[model samples]
Target: MSSVATASSGVSTPNDTRAGASTPWRRVIFGAGVGNALEWYDWSVYAVFAPFFAQQFFDATNAVSAMLSTLAVFAVGFVMRPLGGIFFGWFADRLGRQRAMVVSMAVTALGSLFIAVAPTYPSVGLVASALLLFARLAQGFGIGGEIGASYTYLAEAAPARRRGLWSSSMYVAVTIGVLLATVQAAALQGVLTDEQMTAWGWRIPFALGAVLGIYAFYLRRGLPETTAFSNARDTPEPEKQSMLRGIWENRIAVLRVVGLTVGGTVLFYTWAIGATNYAITVKGIDPDGALWAGVIANLVYIAALPVWGAVSDRWGRKTNLVIFSVGLGALSFPLNWLIQGSVWQLGLAMSVALVVHAAVASILPAMFAEMFPARVRASGMALPYSIAVAVAGGTAPYLRTYLAEAGMPSAFTWYTILLLAVGLVVIASMPETKGKKLE
Candidate 1:
């Protein structure tokens, strides 16, 4: 065993190894994956249902204006992500990953519940809007913490050689959550009248998300703490340093997290969240067909995740990241231009873009976790990563919508290409850390 692994593992006897080995893989994956699914599910459903709920909480005079207002609230939620990361990351380091995860899930569920029960604009006037904003802020905070804690836990708990493969489960769970939202949107659209959907149907998913969050919280509470965190807790230096000092000590890695995420998060939101919106709102595709196509595309994304995870396991993390940045940089514009309003075109474009995205998405947990020692891994990664996603990813849908509305849709395409180019440079500069032992 590597020195780091041995230290993290403590002075393990044969019985200790046997005990660790006996823990079911199903439990590990579920504990981490379910909460992750809840986070993405809530986010995905918000985007999926935003068109339906826009007038419920915002101005009803102009459809486009209301949609933009709803999306702005979506962005507002993301604004809270950095704060969430800081608080939860610190809590994870000071407490345990398991406890932090449990609390995040609870908070996320509470946000969903608030949204589920929130009054419509007609009923409560602008107070409805304020409540919606608060709900999103709470959800953002929960998801922010959820990302850092979950990523850190998944990476540290995996077997050294299979960390990439194991880490891919994070996005597998995420994609599944997205798929669920798409499916629900399609189902709801098919069953409900347009008026019904706009009025009350939009709240169903949020209510369901709250229930699922409760279940995820239960699962996460059962998760065993990672050995790496246990070891870090025992280290005197790490124990003595405050969260800010610990993060400052690892400032270089923090910056790398920001640089690495800038392009990836933008691309992620572009396809994963915004593509359906683009098709329905921009290209005027039928909502039902576009959402179903989104379902298929999400399935393709899910299937591709573990494949790239396994590929990164063999080919190295840097190699997969280079492919992701370069491939996405080259293809983004062409793919964006390819969508000309047909459902099939939208599906193909989304599937192709997401397949490329899976390369980085599959390995992010492992890659980010590898960059820092366990002592500060969650907090070190949380602030920068959340900020990057907030700035780039959160704004993607709004920017794309605004640009397309202005008759310059290609401008957003170029913006994505530029970020991907930046990502390529950062990827080139980063050292390969595949199979590196965790501290």
Candidate 2:
């Protein structure tokens, strides 16, 4: 347990010299990434299989209406995320990062497990929907805390110089989780007929999530509480304020974090999740093809995130975010149009859009975490971030579908672009956080 004294500030920072050249930062990144992946995997299974689940759960004449119902449930899950953020953020700050992570995963695992085993609409009528909603709420609760805890844990663990690279692992894991769900859908589609898919194939992904979540749980068990959290707890008076009070004091920082999160979440859903639905329902691509395209594009995103993160570390967080916002705004409409082209064209469009998305997603964890001090870091970062994500990103797919059904497909794209523009403005106004030590 060697330590380094900050030359400028004279504050002691823990140096991971226990295993020379063997970066503990890597472990921190992997643990946080894995946990986030599991959380996203559990939630994403619902999105990827929404059409099938909608049909199974709700009886509606229009396919869009049924799908809307499914997405509404998905949105409900996100709406609960802020509460999750507050609860788990406080718990992480008070109890320990590892303990908070374990609790979050347990809640998510239980939710996915419930969804995997729940009876269908035919068997249980409204009760089935009630159960599904309850499950999603539970998962949302876990996720609310999961993200902030994971982000703060990784940011605090990494060296200041490499925080961008390490934090990018969170988005890398997110894309990986998305890839896993798409692959699962593709694999399940191969084995089951349309009839079987609607009947039972849809449940397989949820089941898989439960299994994978259990594995993640086991892996996370061995992770240590972050040194920052430990130090915060050990530090004397005035530093020991409640998480809520700290959040109140840092309201402006929370708003800035939320503003940055809005564009990323919206564009992410628009290109990744919403695009999959649009490709299948509007553009007439086969469900399997759409699923495969999503999988491929996500793979590209996962590969590209670390590169962008490293660049951000070298350049600046605000610069990378501005680039991402501008690129995404310029390319979004065209990408949607391209999805209506040939399958190869659709794949190309998605890949490019996601690569652009990688710029913001890669650096967001570090960017947001750097905005607040450690004592209230998790709550300040998680609450507003989750709120923006819930309102903007979570609602994008459903809103886009609704507008499209009302004969305004282009409106959805415009709406996304507007949000991106606002995000860019926010980024322009904010300071670059690169190399800033989290105190």
The best candidate by TM-score is 1
lDDT of 1 at 131: 93
Q: How many angstroms is residue 55 displaced in model 2 relative to the true structure, after the best TM-score fit?
A: 6.9
Model 1 Cα shift for residue 60 (angstroms): 6.3
User: On residues 1-439, what C-alpha lDDT tens digit does candidate 2 reach at each position?
Assistant: 2122221223333554111123344555677778788877876788768877786676545678778777888878888998999899898878877788888888888888888899888777878878888999999998888878888878776667777887789988887787787677777877889888888888888887888778778767877776677777788886589777899998888878877888888888877777877777777887767767777888888899989988998999987888888888888777777776366777889899989989989987788888888788888888888888777877787788888789988998888788888887787777878988766
lDDT of residue 129 for candidate 2? 78
Q: How far is candidate 2 from the true structure (C-alpha RMSD, Å)?
A: 4.4
Give TM-scores for every candidate, taking all chains together and pairing residue i with residue i.
0.90, 0.88
Q: Write the residue-wise lDDT of candidate 1 on 1-439 in tens digits.
A: 2222442443444423111344566677668888778888898899779989999998798889989999889888888889999999999887878888899999999999999999988888999999999999999999999888988888887766778888899989988888888788778888999999988999999999999998888878777887778877888763568888889998978988988898888888889878987889989999878877888888899999989998998899988888898898889878988898899999999999999999999999999999987778899898899999888887788899999999999898889888877777777777989988786
How far out, in Å, is residue 212 in model 2? 1.4
lDDT of 1 at 133: 92
Give the Cα error of residue 278 in candidate 1, in Å: 2.0
Clash count per candidate: 0, 1
lDDT of 2: 0.79
